[model samples]
Target: MTGPTGLGTRTITPDLARGLLLALIAVANAHLYLVERPIGYRGYPSGLTGADAVVAVVQMVLVDGRVFPLFAALVGYGVARLAERAPESVVRRRGIVLIGIGALHGLLLFPGDIIGAYGLVILLTAPALATSSSRGLLAMSGAIGVFVVLLSSGASGPQGVPTVPSIAAPTLGAFLAGHPGEWLVTTLFSALLTAPAVLVGVVIGRSRTLDEPAAHRGRLAVWAAGGLVAGVALGLPLALAVVGVWSPTGTVGGVVAAAHAAGGYAGALGLLGLMGLLGSVSWPGRGLLAAAGTWSMTLYLSQSVVFVAVLAVWAGGLGSSASLVTATLIGLATWLVGVVVAGLLARAGHRGPFELLVRRLTYPRARTSDR
Candidate 1:
């Protein structure tokens, strides 16, 4: 079931979840690159209308905060699996490489790069992740979750002002100069925000929940049902406000935003549970999705590349001109292209270039045949 060498046997649930996550990430990030707009909750533009409004609402509830936590969970799951086989040094080396790659990606393409944040988490928590008991991990997750909720309360800003000034930087030079500082802030914030999900993922991986979904069907079902319902319910108020339907201000708005942010963890778990259930059954296009998952790191970086080219103010200038609807269409197109390219690579028996790079760098002396 394992891959030719270093990678563990690919499982259906995690791979499928990762493949699906990229699409959500694409749509979630497209609007954040927008410029000359008054930012609102979660960096969405204020005063949306028509289809733009609809898209914003949908993304707010289902995609925005949800995807990143899921991505964090997947990374943690992989870390847990790697820790089972590789030495601690190898795991830390992988984290270091990710940080380097993430810095380059953030500086050159998108300032919202998450790889570095996850790398930071891995670097700091490697020992704890490998040794923590279930109860201990859950306790840490709860503590961090409280902190994240508090952090998210201040996430809202005055509706008519730009929240992230760097996103609207006027010139390429200014954008590049401002990005490293922004990336530092974002990496720290992301690491804290996603810590709980990562710990939860380690718990799930330790239990082999997705690896043997059929044996844990009952638990997965509860997670799927409860998590999804809670996520949508908690996210609704923010979605409404973002789409110009509700106008909660003052403390009420802050509470709503915090609740919405908290819902992201539930949504991530819900989606993982749903994927685990799905993994128990055979379906069409599963291979394609798994292939995309195999190349997820490469595809994720490629998304930023495409977005910067198409939407950055200093590039195509579409960030200032494209409607939310158009940007969403572009996101979907980008994901589709990634899927096709990933499938071709799979068919050709080639690993993703980035995957190869990481493998080579992490295991410097390992032979290609062995790894």
Candidate 2:
């Protein structure tokens, strides 16, 4: 929490804003591996009728790529909250531990893991978020976000805008195999792409707009409306392109789609507004949302384990047995469970078990030398 500046510290009060996004992520990420065309266990499930194709289309466009954008944007938000109360040295040391924890998360969980990405984002981007004027930082973040889509998607530069350094998506194993600089290059792109999202979080933290609902009501409503429009405008096209409803292969199309998915980034931010709108008016559900936010890290890690171990690993592999429709249901169920678990657990005078571990590890030990 922030001390005197009052720029961006909150009570660490829970908000349901990010709870939904994190939950959606489990389902969305699972869908990537689970949905297969009707066929046998190993092959794409064959014999799909037209109905199945339709389901595929909806999931592909809306759910698949959209969730990560949401998750990444939230990570940006997280960094902003921390910078208010902590020193850079503190953020940096904490980031190192997060990187280690993320590495452990990767080793134990999915190879295509997000924790590492989030950790990498913090280690590099925290300083920038701390130093830049929020508006300037936001602008820089927008430029970088656009650049990632344009350059990495192998598309024409943004609006035929020229991009100097094109970034490539690298496989973790390949990344590990490559020279030391390769990993830096990979993370460099992540830092660039995610920085804006983090800045937005910082803005929210500083604003306390989400916390004092009555005071911020009108402002949040306005922000929510703008975010929804941006998400739709940018997200739909990107999902369609990736799903091949539009041509899937071109660099330009990919960039466009990535930008579209970026809409979800906007949506998530606006969602905080939407949540505040509801909570401002409602009494019962508001408490639940706040509770969930309190145990967010626990819920977040719990999400990862459940997805990889239970949801995706169902007999014959998660996708092997389930259709996209089934997978979505599983993901939703997982999220609901997480909220309940978080709420119950938070009131029981504890954080998430895993989160406790993360905290213990992330906090530095006094060096024997220093002592």
Candidate 3:
């Protein structure tokens, strides 16, 4: 058990899982800066060639719309873990810090940043975090299920004109150049999309299931299997569209989109389950990943920083026409750098820079050495 603000006894599984998830997220996001193709679902390119086509196909099946939810779940897990021991004010401070960071991240780096969404979710779900595990679980499950049902049933939310960011040489420059109103709209949409997953994550955190994966093998396995199946089933149609196998239109398209979105939750749960199982055994790269995962918050922002520096139109400008294979390689390289940085930090017994920053912000009264 960890103290509210303490990093506590670091669990190998969540860190390892998060490290892996970060790589997956890298692969998923690597192509977003490429302005050559039309934006499609999950940011998949509409046009593809040779190995790029193959990469796109594989990403659709396994990567896109998958890692975010898993990451969100981890967010909830972290919040719940802290909430179980820390004061509500402390947790709220953490949430506020995240929101501030996320807003800055969006304004300066990636427009599609999920950090802001996660922060909002934490703030919104603070009250529920204090409830008993059963009650929290019920509320989480009910809200998610109801939202999914509504979307799949073809109901609509408030209608607004879809806003698309323009292609600009410096991608960061483009985000900066975009209208503030449009950015806010997109950011709000992103936060709404991420709310359910974060709530579910909080439920997972509250249960402490990941703390002892060996004891939860059966439960983890079942969740993994069921989640994989449900996710694939719901997401198949959308995946088909992504890879050029099918095109969905009108209300049917909307329903498929909803199912695909809901499928992300299942996919994330399944991945978490798999990670829990892997933690039960000593797996290769586990050490490296665990190290990286520990620095997840810092590294997450670091990824965007690196992306902007290397691929932005005004920067490296390498992403405008990068093939899927090329982008994937770049993403992998980025994640590898994170692994190295994390290893170094772990050896020094230091938190990742941003991680420490947030900790300090959240607990200003706590000693600097506390984290």
Candidate 4:
């Protein structure tokens, strides 16, 4: 049998999606560091008006709870590809390595790290992922979907009160003290929340949906159109509530939040389908975007580094005073810089530092020789 497709032969769609949507990840994460404001739903600061409120609404609709699922799906797709060429042990090793890296990242830099959670999910689900039938995959996804909805529905915070303050730690000592517990809890929770998307991505990868978009154009178009429409419509109520256009209470609020979380999966699918559709086309800066995607892991970690340097109180001390608008701009600028750096790296024939690390640990010479 043919071995797995190498990076040189990998499709563009997944990387392209990662490259572009990572900016949304940056934007979504940036505001969570704003320490001076009262925290509200979904970690956004409360009592906003004017540009900040508008930005909040837009973020809720387009960015929040959306990018990560898409990334989880991409990771799943990658797992599937690896399973095709390597033993299950290798896949598990990769997941383990990611968890270790994520732990360090969480404790030292950002407590909101998802890499460890992804690793946990992969470690737990690798068996099913490698051997499950399509029906089995769908069943797993359905079960996880229900869990996500229930979790989201039950999630609540006192208005104008920060639920997770460690993310905005006021001092180096405080950050070190608080992040370990915070990381542990959030990593587990994130694993549960993102599992459904990852399973669905496995199904997509099995079908080579993104890899062979030309063969699935009609289906991709439908997913792109329907998923986006449904995602936006479902997310609108929650977005409005976040902006204080209307206040939802009791059952209404729970239902709205549940719907928003569900919509995030649809949004992820829509975005992936859209990227698949765009895979064969040429555009200005497409290469640069693809390069960034290729170096996604490094870029992801770099964002946290930059955010900590510029926004953390113990570092740049801007988080205590930065407005939502300022945070969003910073996110955009960070993404732009990352893209340029990724492009330069690609031109120089270098892999992302983190990617290189993962590859080295995942495919050691002894292991490869044995295989």
Candidate 5:
């Protein structure tokens, strides 16, 4: 069942799940590069057209903070899959590789990168998941939840992207073409905010539900339903506020933020469960998505490349001019390209270039045949 630094069983669902996740990541990230308006919740743009307002509303409710936790869940699942065939050292080494790549990625292109956060969590939690009792891990998760609650409790303000006077798509150039120190602070804050979701992902990984989702459909169904309901109940009001429907100020705002902080993760888990349920049904383009999942790292890095080229001031300079509809189209195009290219690469029997590099780093002495 083992493959060097790769999944042991080659399950289609996890990769398929990853494929869908990349699209969400693309949409979630599109807002950060926008310069036409002030930043709103998690970098979503403000001053919307009717269409943009609707897009923002949908994204806030479904896309914003939900995607990364699902990605983290997949990462934890990958670690678990690796554990089934390799030693703990192997998992740790892979985590180190991710950290290095993530750090470099954040410094060079996007400061909001979640890969680094996931890497830190892997380094911190791999051992615990391997050795701790389920109760112990649950307790640890509870502690992390409390910390998240405390960190988010101070939110009593208007809901929107924070306006940084000196920072814009141009200064984003600093991250893309400059040094690590420039973006390090932003990167650190982003990583901290992402840590709780990563820990929750680790717990889900231990469940082994995603590992063989078909066998656990009933349980996943309940989780999918409950998580979906909880997520929407907490998320909808916030979305409405972002689009100027509801007021997210004062105690109401603080409560809304807390709900969002918690509900985003719930939504992510619900999506994961839903995806697992859908994994059982036959679908078109399933193979393409599976391939994209297998090549996720390469595709993820590629997304930043596309963003910089299309949006950065020094490049295509679409930053302020690109509307939500335009951004959505760009994101869709990027995702489609990722799926197609990944499928072609998979068909050619080649590992993604970045994936191969990571495997080599993770297992330096291991031969290609081992993979």
Candidate 6:
């Protein structure tokens, strides 16, 4: 299960599964950045067209709120993995770094910045959830997530896209100074919204269900099927209903704006099931994805920067009033650009630049001047 450097103890299947989770978003975001760019899906307009529309339609049908939850779940699973590898004290310290990163990440929430919110979730929730049993924590987290989605629905009337920074001002300064109770609200938001995914990770870590794919294929098949039906049935209407309905004001409206966000969550789980099936049993691209997933934190942050640069008004200006289809094509091109760049970098034995920085910070030392 572990990677080659003895650094990866993650079960290969689960690692691959989690890797798949991160990549799933690339599909949609590529479109947003390169094609039919949306301001937000929470309550605002999602202006899709052609391929952008097609991707959106498919995402609405499949992956919507679902991916983040999966990401969160994997964090939970990873937390478990960390605890097993080190003392609680060491783990807690690591947890703080994750939180710090997340806090910083949240500040970076602009059209260009992604995965910052995810950093927030790992920081805020993992410490508390770490104490509970996998199943118990997941159940608790899922219930809370459901509550947030439902509660948000009745309040704001419509919300914007969760991942896209439609309502959120595009700068760290804005989130800090402009938004009232931004810290408290965002912290609370991350906690309730992300608990299930983190918990799901814990459950998977605890159950060791994913590691032995061959042994559990039958169970996975059943769960995947069940997830497909339930996820779609619940996610579709809610997502479509909220189209062009979001407004970026007040707590209630924000919650309602998260309907599409909720659907995204459901779709993420369904996708996990789908991807797990494909990657675990028979994926030609598993090695590449696995490699990318191995250095995930590095790759993730890099993607954000790379994506923005590619889509920015200055660089390629692909973000210039393109339809969903056009944007998707742009996104596809951008993705190829990223994959090739990442692959070449990986081949050179360079982990993500960020990953190297974190490693240095986590374990610093003085040079032996005397020697």
lDDT tens digits, residue span 1-371, model 2: 32222212223233465665666666555554443332221111333335554555454444444556555655555566657666786667556766666565544444445565667767776677668787777787678776665554554122211011111112334423332343344345545655556666666666776567678889879867886666666666644433335544455555665575466567666665666677567566555555676566667667667765553333235654666567667777878887877867665555556555554554445221111
Quantify all predictions' global Cα lDDT against the true fold: 0.82, 0.55, 0.73, 0.83, 0.73, 0.55
Alpha-carbon runs more than 4 Å astray in model 2: 1-14, 35-66, 155-191, 238-255, 311-316, 365-371
Cα-lDDT of candidate 1: 0.82
Best by lDDT: 4
The residue-by-residue lDDT of candidate 4 on 120-239, one tens digit each, is: 988998888768997898898999898888789876333564445675666789978998998899899999989888888888888888887788999999888988888888788888
- The 10 consecutive residues of candidate 6 with the worst lDDT sum are 362-371
lDDT for each residue of candidate 5 in 66-127, tens digit (9 for 90 to 100): 78767877886777667667777877888788888888877777666667777777776778
lDDT by residue for model 1 over 1-371, one digit each (tens)? 12224334567678777888888989988888776777776677878899999888788777878888989988888887877777778778878988888898888878788999998888888888667797898899999999899888886544564434566777889889888888889888899988888888888888999888889999999988988888888899989888778787789988998899888998888878888888777788877887788889999999988887888877777988889899999999999999888967765677888888877787787764323
In Å, residue 85's CA in model 2 sits off its true spot by: 2.0
Model 1 clash pairs are none
| TM-score for candidate 3, residues paired by index | 0.90
Off by over 4 Å in 1: 1-8, 158-164, 368-371
List where candidate 6 sits over 4 angstroms from the true fold.
1-10, 30-51, 103-130, 155-188, 242-265, 313-317, 343-349, 362-371
Q: On TM-score, who's better, 1 or 2?
A: 1
Tens digits of per-residue lDDT, candidate 6, 1-371, equal 22112323335666566455555656555544432333445322355444444456566656555666777767776767765654455455555565565555444433323344445555555456547665667677768777877765654443334334332334345434532344445555656677667667767777766667677677677667877676776555545543432334555455434555565566556666665666557657676655556566665555556555655444555555555555556545544555556645654555666555554454344221111
CA shift of 48, model 6, Å: 4.2
**Higher-lDDT candidate of 1 and 6:** 1
Q: 1-371, model 3: which lDDT tens digit per residue? A: 23324445678888888888888888877777665556555565665667877787677656766788788888878887778778777777778888888888777777677887788777877777776565656576668656754654352221121123432344455657663554466566666666677777776766678888898899899988988788878878777776666667778878877777777777878888888888878867788788788788788888888876776667777767777788899998999998887867765677787887887787686664635
Show model 5 residue runs off by greater than 4 Å. Answer: 1-8, 155-182, 369-371
Query: 33, model 4: CA deviation in Å?
Result: 0.8
